[model samples]
Target chain A: MIDKILSKYPFPESVKLEIKEELEKLNLSADKIKALVDRCYKAYTQNLMEPEEAAGIVAAQSIGEPGTQMTMRTFHYAGVAELNVTLGLPRLIEILDARKTPSTPMMTIKLLPEYAKDREKAKEIANKIEATYLKDIAEIEADIKNMKIIIKPDRKMMDVKELKMDVLKKKIEKSLKVDVFEEDEKLIIQVEPSYKKLIDIFEKLKDLVVAGIKEIRRVIIRKEGDEYVLYTEGSNLKKVIKVPGVDFTRTLTNDVWEIYEVLGIEAARNAIIKEALETLEEQGLEVDPRHIMLVADVMTVDGELRQIGRHGVAGEKQSILARAAFEMTVNNLLEAAIKGEIDYLRGITENIIVGQPIKLGTGDIEVTYKFGGKR
Target chain B: MKVRLQDHILVPKHEILSKDKAEELLKLLGITREQLPKIKTSDPIVKEIGAKPGDIVKITRKSLTAGESLFYRLVVD
Candidate 1:
C-alpha cells in the first residue's frame, strides 16, 4: 500500500524508501498515509542542503550571530535562595568547554505518580535531599582547658530532620574514634590532650554528617503545572535516581559531565545541546537547533565528551596543523615534528591555512577525465 | 558489573541488524561499512547486544523537532 502511493511521486529511491518506512510508523490508513507522505516529501525536498553549501560556516554563523545578544551574568532560580543557575553566554561557554563541573550544578527531580500529588511526601523528599551536617543541627564549643568538645543538640533541628541524638553520637564516635559521653543536653567528646590533636579533632567535628543524603545541600519542591518537582542546589544523579519515590527516568542534572557519567556519551551530547540552547534562550537569543546539534555531534562523535576548545576536541584533531592553528602553536608543531607525525591536510583548518578550499561540500568531491572517450 | 546502556537517556532504540537485512541496507544505500556512521565495539549498547566489529546496528530515536528518525552505524573495534 505504501509502495503504491510512494510510486506515484518521482522521488529518489532513498526518499521513497524512507517515506514508506515513516508512513508505516505513523500507522495511518491508506489515504491519510499518502497525504502525510506527500507533506513529508515536500518538507524533505525543501530542507535539503544544497551542493557546495558550506554547512560548517553556516552553522557557526547561525549560533555566533545570536550569541552576541546573550546576557553576561547568571540567572537565579525564582523562590530558591542563592540557587543561581549559570545562564546566557557564560553557560554556553561552559558547555562547549566541557567544564569538569558546572558552575552551579543542579537537578530537576520528578516524583512517582503517588508522591507527585502529595505535599507531605514532597516535603519528606526535600528533607531527605538536603544534606545535614552536625554543625547545622548542633552547637559545638571547644574547651581548650579541658581538651574536649561540647556538642549541644538542637532538638528542633534534629526533630525536623528526623535525626536521633544517639545515632549522631554513635556515628561521631565511629568516624572520629573519640570518646563520646551523653549528657542531659550536650554530648561531650573527649579529645586528645595535645594542642595539635585537639585542633585536628575540632576541625573534623564540624563536617560530620548527622542525617540525610550527602552532596545535596538544598532542595526546594514546588508545584509546576500539576506535579511537585524538586529543584536541588547540588546533584548526585546516580544516588538521586535510587530514591524510592523518584521518577528516575525523568530526573535530570544540569551538569553535563554528571549526565555523561550516569547516562553515557549520547546523553551527554544531548545535554550539551540542551544546555547551550537553554542558555541562549534564557537571554531571548534564538539559534537553530540543527546548529546546536552539529556542535553537539562534533563534541561527541568520538563516543566521549570533549570540549570544543583546546585541551579537548581541538587539541586532539588528527591534523597537526589544525591542532597548532587552535592554540599552543609552537608546542603543537614541535611535538608533532618530534613524533614524526604526518599531516593529512584533510580538515578545513589545515586546508585554509595553506590558502586552499576546504574539504567540504563541492571541495569534498573530485572529477577526473579519461584520455579515451567511450562511443 | 556495568549499568545497562538501554536505561541511558539518549541511547535510543538499538537493534542488531541480521546479515540479510544488513546486506539489503548496504545495497539500497550504495554504501559500504566504512561510509556508515561508526559505533565503537566497546560502546555499552553495542556490547549489550553482543554485536561484533563489522556488524551493522540500527538505531531509531524520537527527535523533539524531527519526530522519529533512524540512523545506522557500523560497529568498529
Candidate 2:
C-alpha cells in the first residue's frame, strides 16, 4: 500500500522512503499523505544541487575548518591500561589515508544473546578471542646450575583465564619441543642440558601464545547495561566474526582496509565515514557527516580504498597539471614530459593554475545561447 | 550458521539490473557502461550476488542526508 502511494509521487526513491515511514505512523488518509508528500517533494527539489555547482570545494571547506580544532591525542582507557585507541586529528588523518592497518587497531565485539547475558559465557568468549601468552599467566625461572626451566603457573591467574594445567603443558611441549611434566604441582620444562638451551627455552616460553586467538593481544570484557561487551586491543575481523557466540553483524573493527578485504568496498566506505565521524565527535566538534561521506565516497567509488594524497586520488588525476601541482612537482612534470603526456586542463586546480576559469558554474556552460544575440 | 557479506548492515541491498534497465540508466546518465564506477567480479558482494562481468549492480546505500541513495556499479574483471 505504501509502495503504491509512493510510486505516484515521482520523487527520488530516497525521498519516498522517508515520507512513507512518516505516513505509516500517522495513519493518514490518501489525500493527507499526498499533500504531505507534495510539500516534501518541494523541499527536496529546493535542496538539490544546481547544475555545474562545485560541491567538492564546499565539502572541503566544511570539513577542513573544523578539522583545525581537533586535538592530537590517543584516548587511553582508564580501566584497561593495555588498550589505547587513536583518536582526534591523527585518527582522522589515518582514516582518510586509508591505512592498511590502523596504528592501534581494535574491535568492539558484541556477543550473541546467550553469551552476552551471562558473565561466565562472556568471559569464556573473551578467553577464546584474546591471545594469552605464557608470560601472562606464568613465571619462568631458569635454574642455571641445573640447566632446567621451571614454569610456575599462577593458580589464581590460571583460574581467571580458565586455562587448565594440561592445556598449558601441551601448548608448551608442542611449541618449545621440550619435555614438560608435572612436578610438585608446577609444570617443569626439561630443556637440553646445555646452558644456552636453558636460557633459550626460558626466553621462547615467555612469548609463546598458549591460548586464544593469536592476533588479539588483549580482550577486556566490560559490563555495559545488563550485558557484557568485549573490547580487543588488536583486530582480526576475519577470525573474530567466525567464533561461536559472537554477534558477527554487530562486531566492528576500526581498520577500514580489513573491512574492504573481508566485507567488500561498500562496507569499507561505511567504515571510513563511521571512523572519521567518531574521531571528530570524540573531539567535541560537530561537523556535518555529509562532508565526511563525500570524502568516503570519492575514496571508495572505484571499489578500492584510496588515500586522498598524491599516492592515490590526487596523483591519479586525468589532467597532468593537477597531478604535478599536488606533490612531487618536479618528478611528475619531468615524467610527463618524458612520456609526452597531455594536460587536458579539465580539473579546477589545473584550470586555476593556467589562469582560466575552472569548469564550474558559468565556466561549465560552454554553449549557452546569447539572449537576443547581443553583441 | 554460514554468514553472508550481503547481510551485513554496511553492505546495503545489491541487485543486478536487467539489460533494458541498464541501457536506460546509461542513456539517462549520458554515459557509457564503461564510465560507470566499477566493482570487481571478485568482490565478495559481487560473488555473493553471482553478478558476472558486464552486469550492472544497483546498490541501495542508507544515507545520512537522504534517507537512502541508489548507486550503480559495473562488474569488471
Among these predictions, the greatest DockQ belongs to 2
> What TM-score does chain A reach in every model?
0.86, 0.86
User: Each candidate's iRMS in angstroms?
Assistant: 4.8, 1.7
Q: Could you tell me how far off, in angstroms, the CA of residue A238 lies in candidate 2 after the best superposition?
A: 1.4
DockQ of 1: 0.29
Per-residue CA lDDT of model 2 for A232-317, tens digit only, reads 98999999999999998888999899999988988888888998888878778988887888899899878788899988888889
Best by TM-score: 2
Of the true interface contacts, the fraction found in model 1 is 0.15
TM-score of the second chain, each candidate in turn, equals: 0.87, 0.95
lDDT per residue for candidate 2 within B1-77, as digits (tens), equals: 99987877777889999999999999999999999888887789999999999999999988887767899999989
Q: What's the CA error at residue A41 for candidate 1, in Å?
A: 3.2
For model 1 chain A, give the 10-residue run with minimal summed lDDT: A73-82
Off by over 4 Å in 1: A1-43, A75-82, A370-375, B1-11, B18-57, B73-77
